[model samples]
Target: MTQQGARWTADQVLALAPDPASRKAGSKLGTAGPWSETGSADEGTVWGLCKGSGSKPYQTVVDLADAAGPAYKCSCPSRKFPCKHALGLLLVWAGGESSLATVPEERAPEWAAQWLAGRRKRTADKAEQRAGQEARSAADPEAARRRAERRAERISAGAAELEQRLSDLLRGGLAAAEQAGYGLWEETAARMVDAQAPGLAARVRELGAIPSSGPGWPARLLEECALLHLLDQGWLRHERL
Candidate 1:
């Protein structure tokens, strides 16, 4: 798995993408060929924008400070993971293209800068607030310890429940999951949400589409199920990770 704050490289980003055809198409559409400017820190997120084929270019953002994993939201219609646009943008940034342009003085278009200033300010404020909270908690260690214990207990319980559900799904047979269709997946997804596993819930929802996915439905379903099982096991064993 990719490590947080690992400093993405051109080859690494390209490797995360699906295929060359998709990458070429995205480049043609001006989705992710090069960067105008790039910014990041050892403990900070990386942010950049790429020219897209649509009316506006796509925004590529990576929060390296958190291990939650990278997120990409492109305007393109492709559904592949780390879509080619995201891969290309990361590749450009990783290639040390930050010096190409000085920071823009005029505010970027509204949509582009909407979260920039606010997020920076919020980060600063949150840091200060957390420091104050830490000082106070240190003075009353017992209370802090209790809170930590309770939070850990809740996370453990939730993970255990998720594991049991996965085992049940496997033993009950995933073949039936297709027959029940979207409703089954949605119901399972709701349960995942309640368990505070929204990512897994989204994964489960995607599984619903495999049945009608035409060729190799069985193989696809099995692959997705194996992935789900892996996620469940990972979460159970390493909740903090």
Candidate 2:
């Protein structure tokens, strides 16, 4: 829905379920049997009325354009973040023209229109607020430059320190590093964190996974180490780059 009229896959819709039970329950209602007034909009909204045990059918709506993944709302009493009705509606929507029809904005039911209008308004507000903040930050160019310089200094220091550690590890032999296991990498990653170098810390943390990555791990580890070493060198000499 977010990328033109491209419909979601069944697996993608099912993946949003809070748990296996929700997936199972939601799957049962995916067909047209228990649903009516089911429709989707090109603007990434899906809504339907699902027959429930109660006399009145439950209303379910999904907003695919929501920044935080697909947002769901259903009149059902289920406490799940995405109630079964919402999941079913999404599942039906994912099936494309054969399963669900597209209703024009003006033709959409009152309840669904109200919710969609509110959501679009809130999303617009958030975008406007973010633009204002970015404009304010841009207004103080000197302060922005100073902040960038401080972060660069920290990253440079982290890179130099990481280079030294890699040199030591290679000198002591990769077998020793394998024996040292995750502990060595975790400790090194902590130092990168202290330096406020999130990128370096993340790379170091990933190195810890190499040992348990099955056969030929040593070769894989060595290759990754070479790349990390190169990254460190590049960061250290970024001014020349």
Candidate 3:
């Protein structure tokens, strides 16, 4: 609570604990006895190395940048979110019991820098995705429907053209395919791509790749060609289904 705001109150720190035991444990360690290399950077991220039972200190970080929300990360093996270490950190910083909680004049440590950078990137990506969704939601439904219809029409035309290619291949016999080379299939796939029929384009790409699909590839090629033909016919007669 009170993320991205001024220093947190003691009650606010306790309120975010995973359990009462965590809150009590956090309160005990809040005075910075076992904590070191502690400081706030960027006015949002507070971090420190908490000496625990283990020989190495556990790294704890709490994000208070959002104001609307807060997040916690710790290198300790606690199953709890905002584990004791994190809560202790919030307490240590907010209580201002130790110089460890002061703003660092130097750059953040390697661990804090890495985590903050990753968190920032994740926030940016989520913001972009949310913006896209909001834009789509705000778009005119009629215009969206018309755009979809245009895409469908283009796909249908591509499918029909693919059907013609499949028929020609069948008429010429599957044996000639071994000699036809991938160039012809590549061209057809490119045309389907241009026509906006990703399904047809992918089918053509599979056809191109079948020749090199190891031993018994000829049988595989025949099966795949038949499947493509069936897809073409199905699309052409979809109203019947």
Instruction: Report the alpha-carbon TM-score of model 1 versus the true structure.
Output: 0.44
Q: Which candidate is the best by TM-score?
A: 2
Q: Quick one: ranking by lDDT, best first?
A: 2, 3, 1
lDDT at position 60, candidate 2: 89
lDDT values for all models:
0.57, 0.78, 0.74
Best by lDDT: 2
- Comparing 1 with 2 on TM-score, the higher-scoring candidate is 2
Residues 22-64 of candidate 2 have per-residue lDDT tens digits of: 7789899888889998888777888889999999999888888
Model 3: residues >4 Å from true position, as ranges?
1-4, 101-106, 134-241
RMSD of each: 9.1, 10.2, 20.4
Clashes of each: 2, 0, 2
lDDT: worst 10-residue window of model 1: 100-109
Candidate 3, residues 150-211, lDDT tens digits: the string is: 87788788888988988888889776665554446766877887777767876785676565
Better of 2 and 3 by lDDT: 2
